[model samples]
Target: MSEPKRMGRMGRRPGHGPGGGMMPGEKAKNFKGTVRKLIQYMGKYKIAILAVLTFAVASTAFGIAGPKILGQATTELFNGLVAKVSGTGEIDFGKIGRILLFLICVYAFSALCSFVQGWIMTGVTQKVCFRFREDISSKINRMPMKYFESRTVGEVLSRITNDVDTLGQGLNQSVTQLITSVATLIGILIMMLSISPVMTLIALVILPLSGILIGIVVKFSQKYFVAQQKYLGEINGQVEETFSGHNIVKAFNKEEDMLKEFHGTNDMLFQSAWKSQFLSGMMQPIMGFVGNLGYVAVAVAGGMLVVRGSIEVGEIQSFIQYVRQFTQPITQVAQVSNMLQSTAAAAERVFEFLGEEEEDLTAEHPVKLENMEGRVSFEHVQFGYRPDQVIIHDFNCQVKPGQTVAIVGPTGAGKTTMVKLLMRFYDVNQGSIQVDGHDLRDFNRSELRENFGMVLQDTWLFKGTIMENIRYGRLDATDEEVVAAAKAAHAHRFISTLPGGYEMELNEDASNVSQGQKQLLTIARAILADNPILILDEATSSVDTRTEERIQRAMNNLMKGRTSFVIAHRLSTIKDADVILVMKDGDIIEQGSHQELLAQHGFYAELYNSQFEAA
Candidate 1:
């Protein structure tokens, strides 16, 4: 239960590799499939999405009409000036004023439409994010223990946090922008063509050139972007590992080696990042150059048309404005393409997690054995964490009600594995584990677990008061009961001496307290649970001899009428057990009272002798 070992089993981010980092805009392997899945997931929000799309189109259409409408004002002003110059008519100031006011109203209405769509889209995105998080949380509880053991904690958490968040933000932006970009492109094209199809054709020449340039930049930069993301994760992992194990590195005098490793990772990250940024950066300027060429060509073509009376002078101004507006949507489309990839990647991860194999907690004809007396039996149980590697073989054991069974073995002797099997954390590959003559699987997993209490070597305490932490064992337990359990576990005395007594709040990880204190809190939790069956795995390992003695006395009282399985490394703790089972490799080598096992002079005797010899 060392810190690093605990972290390896359940670390928060586990470095910035697959499980950590936002990793925005990453390419998805199955882009089309993922997008299809996302659309299916979002099907319930179709109405809201449709509203957003409608409003987005309306906003773009209204925005597109601004330049053309203003062009009308320009035409009116030009006509008035020509008339005044020719001394035929006075300038129509009132008409020009009316036209300007109408243009303002149109722009204002467009802004309003944009705001309404954004608000609606944001709500939809957040709702989708909320559902994703809820589903992931629920999915975790239904998942098999093996699934968690086979992956890092961060990897699972990434689906709920990073992936969902990325999906939400990308969804909010990409959907609206895509709709607006396409709408704007279409609306602008029609307006340009309406004014002068010849000049519109001239303006359209920028598309292929811009497309080729953008395609080349994206093609070259994509690999670098991927590499940059990879090396960034690697470098972050190095930094996290180094800092978390700084003391170990210093103790081993490996500072130089750590630094060298960091330098190597950092250099690679730098190379990829700069190259990707430089190549992607070239996109805007290149597009702008091509656009400027198109603008110049359109300007020349419009002027020729204007001189020949093919189009009006004000029409030339409107066409130039349309040309400028045209390139923006194309740029947005390119940008949205990258965003969609990111959205697809994030959505894919989330969908993958939600689609994982879940444990079948539902038993069709569940055995309802109430008032369980805790008679347990492991009949020819065989199991392994992996299918190909069987660890426990023919692990047969039986314990009557209200008996203390002590399992003693070396580190890799399948001691903990048996406890896990009994609890149904994992099912036996061969044979069955039964409780009160009923197969473990016959009962619902939750109902089966409700009859047992567990206190492990590795203590876990959330950020809460000592009373709350203890009361976690039984949510409805009163304050007096919590305090009583704490006293039984010998944690009350230390708790009372603290600043807030039983009301003292523990920090995250509970590092504010000593290891022994944390262990005592967990023991208190188990005691408060008051279950019919108890499993204690090296529960007293963290405490000193004096505190251990006190807790042992309390444990003796607590186990008075309950069936208890005590898995211990320290042989002295289980001397008074009703039966001592000594396991070696996988099977039990000997089973008897402590005195009887000592008389056998076998593996258990050797193990007991070695501990005293070392002491």
Candidate 2:
């Protein structure tokens, strides 16, 4: 959420990404620009948005105008009744019929305006929702590794679904009501002042009081809404945790602990939501009650004025309708402020995501990678995940094209960091990584990544058929090509025996499949990708001895004529490497062929002896 990083080196490094730790609530800066940026999303559908506004205004004018005509007709009907009862008695039929017709027409026009307003509101809402959903999804696609690292799955999903939903509902319901409220207030105020200045003044004396009360409530309500959003995010994070780690929870018999965590978050959300709603819900009825008091005052004053022949009976009736009209705006203004804040909060989150920084990859005039031969080198590289601890310090190594290199060491010895550097997930703090003769910084990020295939110690096979999972390796690959890769990875025979063969469905994370099979399927994916460089980070460490042989065979098939990096704790995988490097605390402690290092009886020799002796 910080500025799209200073590629020019202008400020302190952001903590989450590169330079340093970010400000605690650094995300709020992008929120600061939300309304402005959100307005930008409306550009594609501005015509629809404007249409909604136009219909809203027109509807209010017609709706408020109808009530005024109805008020006049009611006054005439009353006066006629009085004359008839006083024995001057003939009610005029023409006046009665004409007023009846006018009343019918007024109701008819109001219905028509309501329909038009509803249609435009629907269009506007759809357009806004579409824009928000599409933009958020696209941003997800463009976002980098660190964004996912920093936020939980639940928090991200909540913004995509819950926050956008809140914005949509609030916008659709409130906009039309706000327009009607404002227009009605204006029209009604004109009629009331025309009736009599003194009565109008008296009716409006309580109007400012309503505003003052609403403002006070509004100020406090925003704070509660902010708390509500925070708690909602917490609840989302917990729910995601429960689902993702459900197996672990049950395995450890920690279901009760998980339930307690969920309930705590749920209770927090409930309290926050209740407080916000309680204040917002007070607006309409409270304002209506005060407006009713003003109505009583107006009726008493107008009755005396009419008796004094200072105000007409019909005019006094019209003034009562105007007082009702004025009350509505006061109520609406209160409600609208809550919706506005809800919108602002949602916009803030959305804009913050849109503004988040990604690792700087050259976009214009990018270095093109063509037919990469995959000679990789690290030149005095210094890198660290934290400021206090440097992982890779002044490390240097090189692998020629079509060579197989193995990195072995204790845990946290920067074996995996080398592969990450080759992949450019994180840039080095000092020194350089180069492929062939070109510095990594010069390569287009996607172009550079496309050259390598990786198989981690922990295999990643999503819930899908084996064919679909392999097809993920290269999206444009043919079905026949997928089958060929599966055969190469030695996964085809077992897949053929399954009920649906390569079409078999997997359990969540492929839990139904053996860990070795999952690892092979991921290897099949890598084989299908057909890149010039391969990285195996403890790839066969999870498999059984027989499974490791099968994987070593598939890995051998994939590594032929390609540059490969193997980070293996099992000394067997490294024994056949072109060169083996033993690393410790992010620096190379020994480097040689396997036999050459064993003769020296150094760190690699000790590690090899310990494992082989254990066997």
> By lDDT, who's the top model here?
1
Q: Candidate 2 residues 536-608, lDDT tens each?
A: 8887877788878887887887788999999998898778889898999999999989999999989888888
- In order, candidate lDDTs are 0.88, 0.77
Off-target runs (Cα >4 Å) in candidate 1 are 1-22
User: Residue 604 of model 2: what lDDT?
Assistant: 87
User: Best-fitting candidate, measured by TM-score?
Assistant: 1
TM-score of 2: 0.83
Candidate 2, clashing residue pairs? Answer: 13-19, 13-20, 14-20, 15-20, 15-21, 15-22
Model 2 clash tally? 6
Give per-residue CA lDDT, model 1, range 1-615, as digits (tens): 011113332254434334574566778999999999999999999999999999999999999999998888888888889999999997798998998999999999999999999999999999999999999999988988888777777777678878898899999999999999999999998999899888877777668988988889989998999899788777777777788778899999999999999898889989999999999899889978988898889888877887798988788888889888899998898789989998999898888889999887868999887688999998998988888888888889899999999999988889988988887878889999899999999999888888989988888788899888898899899999999999999999999999899888998778799999999999999999999999999999999999999999999999999999999999999999999999988889899999998899988888888889966
- Screening candidate 1 with a backbone cut-off below 3 angstroms (N, C-alpha, C), the clashing residue pairs are none
Span of ten consecutive residues with least summed lDDT in model 2: 1-10
